[model samples]
Target chain A: MNATASLDARGKSCPLPIVLTAKALRELNAGEVLLVRANDLAFVSDIEAWCKKTGHELLGIVSESGFLEARIRKAA
Target chain B: MGVTEEALLDDPSAEPQPSGVFETELRRLSQRVAELEARQHSLARSAAQEDKITLLVFSNSLDRLLAAFTMATGAAAMGTRVSLFFTFWGTAALRRENVQTKKSLFARLFGWMLPKGSRNLPLSQLNMGGMGPLMMRRLMKQKGVASLEEMLALSRELGVNISVCSMSMDLLGFQPQEMIEYPNLTYCGVATFLERAATGKMTLFV
Candidate 1:
């Protein structure tokens, strides 16, 4: 699937990655995927929970080196 | 004579009555199961509403404000609904610019001495007159902690309610427009705050 946008929130603290991803999701049309890169230790579960609460679909999360990459699709 | 099982099964409209200890035991277990399920559902509903946090912010010092906002952010992230009541000096923390005034001499003195906004707040201790807050802000950035502004932003995004004390605003000569137009901000008195505090599972004064 093609990504509609990508947000690089690496090195940001708790809530920033989720906050930025949320902001980005607002601008994207439904069914578009967003790629979020975050290095915060809490990013994994935070993103997962955020997606669940906001009704977004967490397509997948891949861990690379010391950071994490999450792909989330906006729910229609 | 006792009813025969063959007749009970063959008759579609037959009312089969249990006459033994096993049937009584089975009935009791099913009733117990229904009772337990109701209790479980109520317990879960209470748990979900029990994570509320009420923060009474009375200090305007930089360190204290930082602590208050950090706690607000953490509690909100943990799925707790948070309500912040700003009073006295705490009201100054929410101001975007210095509130213009033409009040009494004493009121003017207090207004001049107090920090005008979130960025101008003084450190509670070891301020070295002014450098302590600056140093701590830099250190917080280096440590990857969100700044007070960032936390406040997150708090708004997470629906943390921010309210200003009306009495304090009047005493301090602050108009509502002087403070940042935070989302859903309201001006209320102590009674309103008490109502919120009474319902919250966790209440804190900072």
Candidate 2:
């Protein structure tokens, strides 16, 4: 079973949400999962674009009560 | 036709050395020269961009960029002509709406856990289950980046122009005309911002 980590980065801004997610993802080996909880509207597009450009897998995005959560898998 | 005596003596047909290798070296040298010229052009462009009044966007999460804005605005005070155009959640840092004026004794009993000034209203859409704002505050303390309210204060002290988007005003339930005056704020529309951005030499979308 692969390990998983989570980062709550809701109110943070553009570079930060991405910066922290990358930081957390860095700690995990390839094929690991990182769940990012954020409500920043820009994060949805920014992260998706980041994942696409970097070859990471953006597992999914879902709207919750006050924020959005993104599931991402570290690129193998 | 213009080949010098040295070139004639260095002729590739008479020698065993590879002409292809020499051609490759010439091509590589030309490419390297072109790359150097391109880099110089980019630097010149960047400096030129910095020389004019740049419009910066405040959409991202970290307050470091805010700090940079404050610094630039401070520099602008000595006549740099800097301006900030806030849209979306970035607008929260400029207004007093929905800011928590009260805090518990546990965080800071004598006064409050938050700043006495207007709370940099967290953008509603990116609340991060409320943790994102919390983390930013904690990290601000750890990193010594100024908090939203504090930056608001410095912005006032330094005379930085803070404009809140009128369109955002409608979406966020903020009445621009009724909003508190932070000494550095103004409520305006897209055209208002365009007037500044269009004429200014520097304009950045956050």
Candidate 3:
């Protein structure tokens, strides 16, 4: 997925990834996509729940060797 | 005339005539339901608007302070307004390290007894002569978790409001200069905390 912005949260713990995701999403315009790469396994479900609560669009998630990449579109 | 019970019993299928009083009561009941629904809607809207959490930090222990800071930072990261009101022993965590401030003997003793800052705070349980905090810090580092100092700094950076209790300060003889430098920090009494907590979605005592 092509993202307007990217955030690398590798090695960060639970809340930091989500917290930093929210913070990074704030900097982007509505409808823009934010690609986040995180090694925390919890981010898989956390990003889904966060997007549901915040009305963002979770495009998809891809799990690679160790990190998980997620693309989220900011809510309008 | 309204249909009588005896008449209805005789002819079960017969329709009863509507009375003015009964119609008036029905209209009032529907209006009341509408009013209540409107109130419920507005309450939900206000709750969404007031996405805030207030925490009363009353302990200075390393574990409790860490918990408090973690919650504050997490809530702040989620775009919620967070307020931490530090009172009594909790204010010790805000002290700056190695600051020599002139004080009376009693005040000096009080200062000496308390932890210098977040880094020096003792574990609430199983302190084991300060070894518990050391082990906990090492464990946190090994897990790649942010330390208490980092959490505190992040909380400030995330715009978490830190309110120090002025009464606690007066009682402890702690001067403002001895406190760590934090943005959005304020010195206020309990009333200020109450006011902020009142408008918040949740208030926690830590």
User: Judged by TM-score, which candidate is best?
Assistant: 3
Tens digits of per-residue lDDT, candidate 3, B11-81, equal 74554543454577789999999999999999898777478899999999998988888788888876688
* C-alpha root-mean-square deviation, each candidate: 6.6, 16.1, 3.9
Off by over 4 Å in 1: A28-32, A48-59, A74-76, B1-53, B70-82, B140-145, B150-160, B170-178, B197-204
Best by DockQ: 3
Better of 1 and 3 by TM-score: 3
CA lDDT, every prediction? 0.83, 0.62, 0.88
Residue B46, candidate 2: C-alpha displacement in angstroms: 18
| Model 2 pairs in collision | A10-B128, A12-B61, A13-B60, A13-B61, A14-B60, A14-B61, A39-B126, A40-B126, B54-B202, B57-B206
- TM-score, chain B only, every model? 0.73, 0.51, 0.80
What digit string (tens of lDDT, one per residue) describes model 1 on residues A13-62? 77567767877888899999999999999999889888776788999999
What interface RMSD, in Å and to 1 decimal, does model 1 have?
3.7
In the range B17-83, model 1's lDDT, one tens digit per residue, is: 5345447777899999999999999989767644578999999998888788877876665557899
Please give the lDDT score at residue B200 for candidate 2. Answer: 69
**What's the true lDDT of residue B99 in model 2?**
38
Q: Residue B125: error of model 3 in Å?
A: 2.7
